[model samples]
Target: MSHDAIVLCRLDELVEGQALGFDPLGTGKDSVFALRHGGEVRVYRNSCPHLEVRLEYRKDRFLSVDGSQIICYAHGARFLPDSGLCVYGPCLGQSLSALRWHAEADWLVLEAGQLEACAP
Candidate 1:
């Protein structure tokens, strides 16, 4: 079966150590966010394991002030940007669900099958 790539953003559009949120599947729920850190881009489901709450306190605000980690403002959980490993907070040792994605030319595309897997 063939699937279409869900474009998230252009490589030049996203700044390093920052993040952008999107609802690529049009699920009506903003459950995905892409983080660019250490010269790499990583996408993850936005739900926090602690309470399954959305990670950002504000829209598209997923990273900590210093941009060293992904922070769950709901409970102050801190996760490694590259690995999504929760290093601190109530849900220690847990991780955000990483989604499959790739950079093609200058666009970041989320794997269509992976996006379907995240469907409700």
Candidate 2:
């Protein structure tokens, strides 16, 4: 991993179509999650655009039953996995704030500076 990046998880640890949440700064609420879909990884802030609530209904439960979209159980918002675009619920046309990350040898690392800029 790069010296300046915050390692989130190993690339091999993420299962396809699943989301994993993390608190890179050790903050309890301003968390982010990563989804691996169709063999690619996408990351987003956990907050729901409509209400500023966490997207998962339960721990790491961010994807819809079919694993085709990211679902915010707070109000039933659904977002496109690849783009974080909300396609359903109150936040339609809005998007989840994406976090910048890159794959290293066997890990996923969040851009260190970007994490600070995203602080609430």
Candidate 3:
């Protein structure tokens, strides 16, 4: 697998502002969150800086009230959509770690390190 582009998910699977987690290429842990905002597809490491844990109420579901911000189910923290900055919560001004990814053709190109790490 190439670190430059490793398929993670389908384009149709990730809608605008919707986020999902995938195994990064080198660890058993996985990151989530993909915001389809500002006419762009942005992804981030699915972890709260404050707690170092995943942020989601359900599998593959990361949303705040009205889907406006990324909320952490662990502590009710909220993050801005565009910048992934912590808008309201313990880690104010902090942001989730982002990863380079995109959907090209029918493949979800992701970093190889991301997948190899999280592969079970």
Candidate 4:
């Protein structure tokens, strides 16, 4: 992967409508989630908007039933695929903070200046 690009798992490793957390670029508790929906991939901070904590059922597991929505294991909040908008729970109309990335040469490259501080 390029220095500016995120290390996207191989297509064989990620099924549709699933999300996996990526380690922080450096060393920290902070991390990002790479979500796959159809043929598109969206990246966001791994924290749930409702509680600002990591959301996963297990290691790198962050998908809701039917594998169509992102679910917060902390409080069961649901977010829409692709948009990252909260569709239920206390988050209401809020959205997950996104990081911009592009697929190049079969890798997901995190765009320059696109990383942002996530809500805490």
Clashing residue pairs in candidate 2 (N, C-alpha, C atoms within 3 angstroms): none
Local lDDT at 119 for model 1: 60
Q: How do the residues 1-120 of candidate 1 rate in per-residue lDDT, one tens digit apiece?
A: 126778888878778878988888788777799978998889999889897888888888999888999999999999999899999999999999999887788888887876765565
Greater lDDT among 3 and 4 belongs to 4
Q: What is the C-alpha lDDT of each candidate?
A: 0.86, 0.86, 0.70, 0.74
Residue 2 miss distance in model 2 (angstroms):
4.4
Which run of 10 residues does model 3 get worst, by summed lDDT? 111-120
Off by over 4 Å in 3: 1-4, 24-30, 114-120
Question: lDDT by residue for model 3 over 62-107, one digit each (tens)?
Answer: 7765667888889878988777899888998899777667567865
Q: Write the per-residue lDDT of candidate 2 for residues 1-120, one digit (tens) a residue.
A: 566799998988888978888888887754888888999999898889997888888788999988899998979999999999999999999999998888878889888887774556
Q: 1 or 4: which has the higher lDDT?
A: 1
lDDT of 4 by residue, 8-35 (tens): 5654455686767766556454467787
- Pairs in clash, predicted candidate 1: none
lDDT of 1: 0.86
Q: Output the number of the TM-score-best candidate.
A: 2
TM-scores of the candidates are: 0.90, 0.91, 0.77, 0.81
